[model samples]
Target chain A: MEVAGLILIVIGTFFDLFGTIGLLRLPDVYNRLQASTKCVTMGTCLILFGFAVYSGFSPAGIKALICMFFILITSPTAAHALAKGSYRAGVQLANQSVCDLYSDKQVLKISAVMNRDVITILPDASLRQAIDLLVEKGITGLPVVDSEGVLLGIITEKDIIEYKTYGNVETAKVRDAMNINVQTLPPSAPLKELVSIFSQEDFRRVPIVEDGRVVGIVSRKDIIKFLKEEKK
Target chain B: MIEFITGVLLLSIFLALYRIGMGPTPSDRAVAIDILGILVVGFCVIISLATGRDFYMNVAISWSLLAFIGTIAIAKYLEGKGFDE
Candidate 1:
């Protein structure tokens, strides 16, 4: 039991160290904020849990658990309020940042006769390359992928265009600018489901994922093409 | 094991303190302070465990509560508001 407790403590300590490194190293404030809060909170909670395990259900362990509970509840709530407050207070990214949330329309103007190849950007690719892909491909966004073609996230033209951080946004890594929270679909889903999903959000495209890798993308134009074929 | 926990917490405290000192804006500092408060609770627990006492846990509990309240207040201040509001 003591060994188990020691192991948990050691792991939690490592988490805390990594989070601090992220806080010290990450270029942008938003990234720094998220990395620190996420890792630090988890680390501290784990430490408290370790103490509980070490001391058993005695008063000390119980107090440790109580502290852990307090931390788990309050930390995230505070971070959320802080994030929203920061955004509203105009604390942009590390540079002159803006989140033009309302300005762009999700107009998927690609022709129905589309190539199925899903364009992707590497995590390490400069945001400049991402912009070029968007412009050259005449598309609004591209999914970010690992070497294995695994879907990581999506970067839109808007993300790079307005992001003034770390340097010229062009020089910044796509990993920083890309939106990790992307909507994706499996090819097996029904077309009606796909259409309904498209109608639900402002994103112009959804990468088709199979076994965590991006195989294709579905855009508004593809939906239109599907409708045209159905009419026959 | 306890020594390792102590070292980690000490390092974390310094890092958070650095953030507070060098944080670009008030909000950044507030975040650093928030992190510091939570870290302190863990520190108190470590100290109590090492010292063979239960009083330290009491301190931890109170400290945790106070830290949460303090963070809430600081966050509000960052948003440009008074404490009463």
Candidate 2:
């Protein structure tokens, strides 16, 4: 029994040694956490188990068993907490990381939830026509486009209301009331970026442009829907 | 025979100390510290067996408890959240 226990202790020592090496050699915090948590925990537990075997059913043996159980439960939990905290603290991943499952699972690209069948109005179109389209389509905004489908500007419900309150609605064109300085995002933008933009700028919708052409649009409702789904 | 195992545990502790000294991040250091704590418990157990004194086992038990608590505390501090957080 003593020989068997010694063997186990030697094996555990090697495992512990390798775990420390891995902690030093791993590229990033996450990878290091993986090495130390698994390898060291297992190694320590083995040593405790070996000690228990050597001491038999004595108090020392029972105490060794208790210590092993404590280490087993606490070590992994603590490692998990640390890893999550480091991630949330904005520690950058290693450059060679092929994929980030955490962010990938939580964040969807703007293209994923963007409305591809966008409702757009021509710059030359009348305000009356723009309003008719807005009311008929039940949308708050429409992207203004040129004949070649290049984005010109955007007209929202607020623009129409402003024109109604001040300007002669009969003589107004969509270009006269549309916001020329519109904010647009690429389809590749992450949902987190979209959330920040929406919250900071209070935009009702943002146009998704590729090659300077409006390919899709994402509204506040779309973002809310996506977030609701993520909660599940 | 017991001396050989103690020597191995001491070597393992030395390796863990190197990591703790050169670890790039707080989490790495925390892991190293945790390993060192486990090794200390192992050392205590080995010493108890070598001397035929069961009292060292009590010391080992307390050392393990302290090590576990220290590991969790460091991890929590690194996480920058309260226990509930």
Candidate 3:
């Protein structure tokens, strides 16, 4: 048992040493976190396990077990938190990085692809008027804006369908059928954030706002187009 | 045998310190500090065995807890979204 424990400890020590070396040699903060988190956690846990094996069922062995469990739970979590925090804090990735999925390239910004000539409808516009504009423009949705172009809500085909099922479409107003709680993104937000929103939420289109006015709109088709271009 | 293990652990600790000293980012330093804490815990366990004193085991347990907490605190501070935020 002693010999086995000693061997384990020795191996673990090597892992710890390698982790330190990687930490020193890795190019960026993210890579360093990956190295240190994996190597050091494995090394420390192995050492503790070896200690437990040598000490048997004794109190010291039990303490070693507890320490092993603590290290297992805490080390990786701490590394993840630190990495996320560093990313959020705007720490630049290494220049050698081949690709950055989260990078906010100017080409991927909302302002780059969004249609600036948004065909919008006034809140008081009749459902017939909204439908005519949507059909004429061949669009699935339209932004409901005030006279000053401030976004009030969004009217989509789904809203029109729901409104038609309930009562007379001729009497219904755009505001009556439009979704009031609209999700808007800033023009400068990255395409990655938009992708996540599209995946997680039911929004088919996201309006881009600048200085409290709707500057442009991005839809699912726009994202598909962007991604297709990105592949090239 | 224990002496050899101690020597290796000490060497690793020194390497980790070198990282902490030269790490470019706060997260790198935080990782180094965490590795150093783990090494300290290993040292404490080995000492307890070599000296045949159960008291050292208790110290090891406390040290490990402190190290974990310290690493978490440093990580949170680096993240800038602490409890105050």
Candidate 4:
């Protein structure tokens, strides 16, 4: 074998070993992904190229060349998939993130959707009163707040129907019938996470809670509207 | 000659390993492991050439496939789970 061939092989191996060390030392998912993809792809490609050179254009060299190309094409793509999966999985950034560019900060802060003012209700409110408020506003449901204005539960038309289902609509207050176990979203919560929560849970209305107070309410309709707006 | 390349590859692998150890999160570690897998395949290919055997090339190809599958599976698991409030 030529001395140059041996040198090429040495260089390729060094690149690979260096990439492995990088994979072991990185600090976070995204950063690690960057290191992993860049180092591994380049390292492997060079190493394989070295093998092709050393093999003197034999069948093994051709195979090595093919594998090198395939790795070059697929390595970066696989890294991208890993990054996206990490994002969708709700992995938090390690350092102080400069900004969440993808989030709709305004929508999360807005008091209403499509200009319909969000309203609240109390747990002790009568079913008829709750129904009347819904009819007056032409809204589906309203978040229920306590005396301190903290979110306690939610009252929706579905709650009314369920109350009527057992023929127990008499003197029971909203506390007795309203869905207490609710899904609450923080102001910074992402819409994807919100959707996941809704899908995994049995709740229709989600309360937007900020600083332990009910800021707004999100219903199935709200989610639909948000999705529609996103599509547009 | 083979020994020198293998040794240098070992050194580079150590460097990647260092990155993995200092990673801050699981995703970071996952990425690092992926890079390591590619390095292994490259190493195998070189080994096939130095030793004049077709078998090592096959092993290298298989290693690449296995790495790809592992990466996809882990990514799927990450995306498939839902967050609880």
Per-residue lDDT of candidate 2, residues A96-191 (tens digit): 564577875654688988989999999888999998998898989999999889999999999888888989878899999999888899999776
By TM-score rank, best first, the candidates go 3, 1, 2, 4
> Model 1, A53-95: lDDT tens per residue?
9889898899889888988898888888787666556666653
Worst 10 residues of 1 chain A by lDDT: A106-115
Clash count for candidate 3 is 0
How far does residue B18 in candidate 4 sit from its true spot (Å)?
Answer: 6.3
What lDDT score is found at residue B4 in candidate 2?
Answer: 73
lDDT values of the candidates? 0.77, 0.81, 0.83, 0.72
lDDT of 4 by residue, A127-185 (tens): 77888898998887788898888988888888889888885666667787787777787
On residues A58-138, what C-alpha lDDT tens digit does candidate 3 reach at each position? 988999889889888877877777777677666788855645776575435667777778888899989899999999989
What ranges in model 2 sit over 4 Å off? A104-232, B81-85
Interface RMSD of each: 2.5, 2.8, 2.5, 2.3
Q: What lDDT tens digits, residue by residue, belong to model 2 across residues B29-69?
A: 77778768777777777788789888887887788778777
**Arrange candidates by lDDT, highest first: which order?**
3, 2, 1, 4
Clash list (residue pairs), candidate 1:
none
Q: Score candidate 3 by lDDT.
A: 0.83
C-alpha lDDT of residue B66 in model 2: 83
